[model samples]
Target: MTDPPKAWDAELVGKWLERRLAAARHDQAAADRRGYEARDDYDKAAAEEWVCRALQSPDCTREQAALARRIKELIGQDDYRATGIYDDIRFERHVRGHLRKLAKMTKANEGFEKTLRYQ
Candidate 1:
């Protein structure tokens, strides 16, 4: 028997990809602007102030998330710095690399190379 009609045309796919690429480029520019804003001297002080204010929150709400929760226990018990932020709030960059590697290994991608071939 003859094959059924295609659900999607190749031309439609090309147009869709072109639009998506254009939108992605626009988003990249906006992201760069945000980075520049963060680097501004005024923004630096604001970031520092936010860190100082959240100093009491364990981890500065920073990288050591689980450990940071214990910070509250130390708040009134002993002499703790009232306004001090840990150097890094979210995490060390290495952790991100590890997470990305794990995700790539575990995530299903029809186009990516997998340990064993499967669609």
Candidate 2:
């Protein structure tokens, strides 16, 4: 019988998640600076779509999936109008919050190996 694929280590998944989140945030920031505003419903939809794609990608681990889900939810909640001046700021805040959570997860997983050694 064929063996099942091994589950990824939480620490490894956390690192991968961190990298993906950073890349996404950087891309969004660059786009924002270029006047590619995300204040409209269409833009929000596109952002949510991108998050959904990331979540469904084969490269996404469990940790990344969870983070992506939160990002998608944030995008859904964004009510910024095209006339608003704080659209970019609000979006950045959401991204930063999620990034912080990703960092925390990475730190928490750092000692995972020690605990598993006893198991």
Candidate 3:
């Protein structure tokens, strides 16, 4: 025979649920951090590869090559302010964006977009 069920402890159940939710939130925060770190590493590696290819490619124009070199130098450095340009920029994204625009205008056939695709 089965034993009779005990009454539910409302206060105890509430405290348990609160702890569970807190743990879930903490886990989510950790996961987000890991995702961000992974993306950063991927971007860095990709930027390095693209810079190398751009520097070596004959199809890359002089201006594009110069921009690529600059981006390569700035990849691991802290963000800086330019004398007459935008203030407080994320170097990688900013320089990368400029290189992309220049490549588009110059109709570069080096497959810049494919090189930086985040898989």
What overall lDDT goes with each candidate model?
Answer: 0.31, 0.44, 0.40
lDDT of model 3 at position 69: 52
Rank candidates by TM-score, best first.
Answer: 2, 3, 1
lDDT of 1 at 29: 46
Model 2 ranges off by over 4 Å: 37-119
Error of 1 at 22 (Å): 0.2
User: What digit string (tens of lDDT, one per residue) describes model 3 on residues 1-119?
Assistant: 98664443333323332343344344434444677544433343333333334334333223444544544554445553333222223335744653454344334323332322232
> Model 1: runs farther than 4 Å from truth?
1-6, 36-119
TM-score of 3: 0.29
State in Å the error of residue 94, model 3. 37
Off by over 4 Å in 3: 36-119
| Local lDDT at 100 for model 1 | 42
Which candidate, 2 or 3, has the higher lDDT? 2
lDDT per residue, candidate 2, 41-100, as tens digits?
A: 333333432433444444344553454455455445555333333456554454445444
- TM accuracy, model 2: 0.33
Name every residue pair that clashes in candidate 3: none
